[model samples]
Target: MNEPGYAIRAEQLTKRFGDFIAVNEITFDVKQGEIYGFLGANGAGKTTAIRMLIGLLSPSSGIATVAGFDVYKETENIKRNIGYMSQRFSLYEDLTVKENIRFYGGVYGLSSSEIRDKTDFLLKKLELEHARNMLISSLPLGWKQKLAFSIAVIHDPKIVFLDEPTGGVDPITRRQFWNLIYEASSKGVTVFVTTHYMDESEYCDRVSIMVDGRIAALDTPRGLKRIFHASSMDEVFLKLARPEKVGDI
Candidate 1:
């Protein structure tokens, strides 16, 4: 049994697609209410690893649990206990802002009364009251991203998984998004996020870097910089993932 303080736990977790091993034996733990950043270049096996952690894809070997439920055996429970947002805002473009909230609330098993209360609260919380009846497609990208994240957590999940959630947003919007993450973390919601933005990695309590399907480094951003003798997460990543670049050296 995993310790009660852990939100995510993996032991020699691995994934293999036939002869191709996508994720080698990787082991790590994320504490309850912690913000953990998962970073990697494209095709570094981050997606495959996240799928296994969130119970979307089964691992060929090893073990993983999310929110205290086995990834393979308790996927439904894991899904229920977690919120997820991808790079593309998952909102329905055709649906009104409030409609989108209600629909997702329903999907998460929120009752009619609960959904109604949440919708009102979300509109005010996200400062979208005036846009509540507006179609999602009509909202600005930043607003849409914020709304998408708010809706994902309508059920008050224990953890939220953000897969490149800040992609394409302006710097100010990205900063606002990080503020939201900080607020969520302060409220005891563990945040598991993946991003290509090296600057974003600095915001995490701890970060794990994947290189060619393996975790080459995992630590606090400052600690990683010290270990790699680099000044920023960007330099650290380049050193770990692509040391051949003369500029990086």
Candidate 2:
């Protein structure tokens, strides 16, 4: 079993590249089944911090763990326990929807029989049974994103990392995508998502905002708004990221 307390825990985590710190010393914890939003602007180091937490990049110092596995010593174990969906949507455009599901299932070490069962369930759930034979490249962007999210958690991973999972989609599609996130969370899957969409941050249970390679604020959306004396996450970000532009908000 993993930790009895948190799905993910980081204490004073820092990542440095040469003399430049991409992720400054930061500390936070994600409880089991929580929807955590890692919010930041383009250069705010959200990706870098997430990379460290996901075991893609090594942290310079501090302590951290994912799914109860030490980040530095048990990365392989961590990898086995988590699913990742990248910003660009982790799907093969050339492959059919069913094919993509099968491939990822295998990569996640599911048996052939398990893959077959999951493929069928996924197709039915996404209402893509009719499109299973169609190439992913032919699908609409919204459908593709929904399918991508479904496949990410096909293996019942303990945690799923979504790096801007709802980018480039219409508001309705984004809302649908969040429904999937909520479904997964209901089943005890911790969701750690990184995105810059201020509107979407409202859907998260809690969010941490990064600014200039450091965590500027971390709180529930309502709590952050209260603390920053702002109306929304965007205004909160403006107050933290660009103090001089605070007047504009």
TM-score of each: 0.97, 0.96
As a TM-score, model 1 comes out at 0.97
Return the number of clashes found in candidate 2: 0
Tell me the number of clashing residue pairs for each predicted model: 0, 0
Cα lDDT of model 1 by residue, 23-130, tens digit = 998898999999999999999998889888887899989889999999989999999999999766699999999899989999999999999999888888888899
Pairs that collide in candidate 2 are none
Q: What is the C-alpha lDDT of each candidate?
A: 0.92, 0.91
The alpha-carbon RMSD values of the candidates against the true structure, listed in the order shown, are 1.3, 1.4
**Which stretches in model 1 have alpha-carbon errors above 4 Å?**
246-249
Model 2 lDDT tens row, 1-249 = 455869999888999999999888889999999999999889888888888878899899999999999888899999999999999767999999889999999999999999999988888888999998899999999999999898889889999999988888999998989999999999999999998889999999999999888888999999999998889888898888889876664
Name the weakest run of 10 consecutive residues (lDDT summed) in model 2: 240-249
